[model samples]
Target: MPNRQAGISFCDGPKEREGREGRPAVNLRTLKYFVAIADAGSLTAAAEAIAIAQPALSRQMHALEEEMGVPLLQRTARGVRLTQAGVTLYEAAQRMLDEAQRVKRQLAGPSEAGESRVVLGVSPTLSRVLVPGLFERCHRTMDQMRLTVREAFTPELLDMLEKGMVDMAIITSMGASADRPLALHPLVGEPFALATPRSMKMDPIISLAALSRIPLLMTTLHRTVVERQLRPMGVHLNIHSEIDSVDAIRELVHDGDWCTLMPVSVFKEARSDAGITLTEVSGVQLNRQLMMATRIEAVPSTAVAALREIVLAELARLNRLRVFNFGKKPVKR
Candidate 1:
């Protein structure tokens, strides 16, 4: 049977319980110390890192090995290395510690100051379009919340979410990945468009085939998403420059005859500009789905829920104003 504590359940499976009847019980603090030692690669280093005495750290590790009835670490002249059993326990302890921290946060709920802290991640492409409205709404309505925004591309954002660095992320959804057990909520579907200099005599629409011949500058992130969809059907982009910065790409496109392929929402501010012409690309349903992702194991705090609601509402408002042409139906991933 699993032991329930503070609304969290922990169970010792058959494999875990198969060992001895007489052993010291390992707790979270000990597991944390073990992890630190493993990460530090030396007991002295671990002790310094965790602010514990060297003797105490050594005793803890010895007791831990005895509890598991296996030598967790092989002490060498220089430092220490994990035994096979230690590797297994290290992996399990990491997961257990992560779960414990998450539960502790959940139990704590809002801060003592009555402010909800939420770390949000947004892709650079969407940050400009979303942040202003989000901040305004939060100030006007959600006054009791402290919001921290991290702006990065899709890949970096996903990595941040997995590491628990960000509470939630709005990113270009590449569907589910087996390695990342995240809960994704589809937010919007945005179509791709081409931004060309006004001097170039072109129609409002261009085919994917014609686009292949035209010289274009593209950001690395957008290129990855667009090419993943277009490449299979014998389509390739004429990417003359692979720049990761959107602003730099836009500046280059404006100064030269170069064009860039990006999500339509990315060029919302430049749509009516006299120097730039935003055109829709045809011959392919080239678009990216935006989704909100959180760790699957997370229990949404009041602040997290509030932040989500505010984001959805902000996107809805932008859609209504035709700021960006959002699809009528958001495709669920």
Candidate 2:
């Protein structure tokens, strides 16, 4: 019998080693060895990186090349080099190795892990309220969650979620929809509030165009702010500036002579400044149902469920505080 290889036992598949297939039977271990060799440009260096013996690695590499049914490396006196075929195969093999590693990591992490890596999209509108509280709760509950957060408008976030690029997203209330492979779970209901400087005397129920000259600090979602707060009186308001930061809006309203229509959450933030008041909208009342959304088939990790529970608990606590007046400077737009 031909001299059997020592490291040949490492190969997982057994069809007489590529028997009848005419191709070398390859496995994950071989792919990793191949990538390491290509990267280091030498078997000795690759073996050092992977903590395997050079001779053992060489045997496996030789077995892999045989399975491939083609000469892969150009082993010249200078060093080992890959032929064109090896280069092409290495590129594809590298991707497979990377994907396999990701799978392994995903599995090893939290079987019921909230720590599973996820790319999450957040709406700027909801971020104004949920960001701080969410972070606090994430730290407290979902210790394993590795979150990559991106802030965008509702339309953009929803688009990313629909594209299956993001794991899940938190978007503003755009009405209920089960058509887009998205399942919405309503969390909080945000009512429109007038965020304005305290010095300005605002009517309990005011119509638009009353302050046609006043500057409007608005986000991209300003339309919802307007239609809900001012459209009842047929007020066609001119938006002076469309901005992103609710904090900046509060600052402009506090320092300069600007007023904006915002949500109750911004009102919560502005309470500290003593210069802004978040007043109930009297003209047209609208509430956005803030929701947590994920793919219809997604199973929430234990960490995600725990985090959600913490958020809901916080929301419940805040709901109770809504009744008690915390005498702070008020900002009502």
Candidate 3:
């Protein structure tokens, strides 16, 4: 009978026991599960992300720990934390999995002869300004490449990138964590502006003090960035609502008295709209850095690099057109 451990069966034949020159056999699938668990910080989340049952994932992990003869995970009240051994294994497995993907891609060849696909992720606000130009440029210049665009919030984009669902993402500096396995390329600096209906009769610029008193609606991500910088200075925002949807916020801002703070590029195209006006906020540095984020482990293929350059070129075109007063000195009271 095959030796079984925690619902996992392993062949007990002489060669299987010896496991390729007296070393324990390593299952690439189990290693992938371990990596997913490490990335997600919990077995439940990892299972959900990969669409496996939690009990089965747990059994696999348990069998892996038993086979390795070392504790890999430490269960905590909040979730699971990797032990020292787990950390070492996680890092190595990450590299191995990345290499395996590279080898697989090499074997499968490009989607077409001399052609490959690259998936890019961007936020809703940035998408409005970047996507149309990006698509146009890719069509004209990157004829051998296929491009797919995904729109989501910063955290969601990060998740997608980590899962290899996106080859690259246009992420804000606020969301790029120092510890993530990502390589960041600076794209542009975007400044936040106070958006209001033109009927509000507000100044072209408002001080931070006055800005704090007004009720505002903001996305959760934007609010976090704002508060992290302002709360320590004794200034607090009177947030009327925290709506994550950009369209919803725009509709509410344009049809009502509530104003919202967001990157200038978000509404740059709507400058000619008679219903709303974008006011610069004074006495605060609301400059947001935009970055091109890619996985540190995966080497960029030729198509990926070409797509990246096209994105940069499109951004340069937007900058030349003054899409959003980028790099300008902040307004003063």
Say which candidate scores most in TM-score.
Answer: 3
lDDT of 1 by residue, 35-118 (tens): 999999999999999999999889878867766667889999989999998999898887678556656675798788787778
lDDT of 3 by residue, 269-314 (tens): 6442567677888877887889999988656778778888888899
- Stronger candidate by TM-score (1 vs 2): 1
On TM-score, the stronger of 1 and 3 is: 3
Model 2 residue runs over 4 Å out of place are 1-115, 118-120, 175-178, 203-205, 208-214, 228-233, 270-273, 323-333
All models: lDDT? 0.79, 0.66, 0.81
TM-score of each: 0.64, 0.56, 0.66
Error of 2 at 168 (Å): 3.1
Cα lDDT over the full model 1: 0.79
* Predicted structure with the largest lDDT when compared to the true one: 3
Q: Write down the lDDT that model 2 would get.
A: 0.66
Backbone clash total for model 3 is: 0
Pairs clashing within candidate 3: none
Segments of candidate 3 deviating more than 4 angstroms: 1-108, 270-272, 297-299, 326-333
Error of 3 at 218 (Å): 0.5
Considering TM-score, where higher is better, how would the candidates rank from best to worst?
3, 1, 2
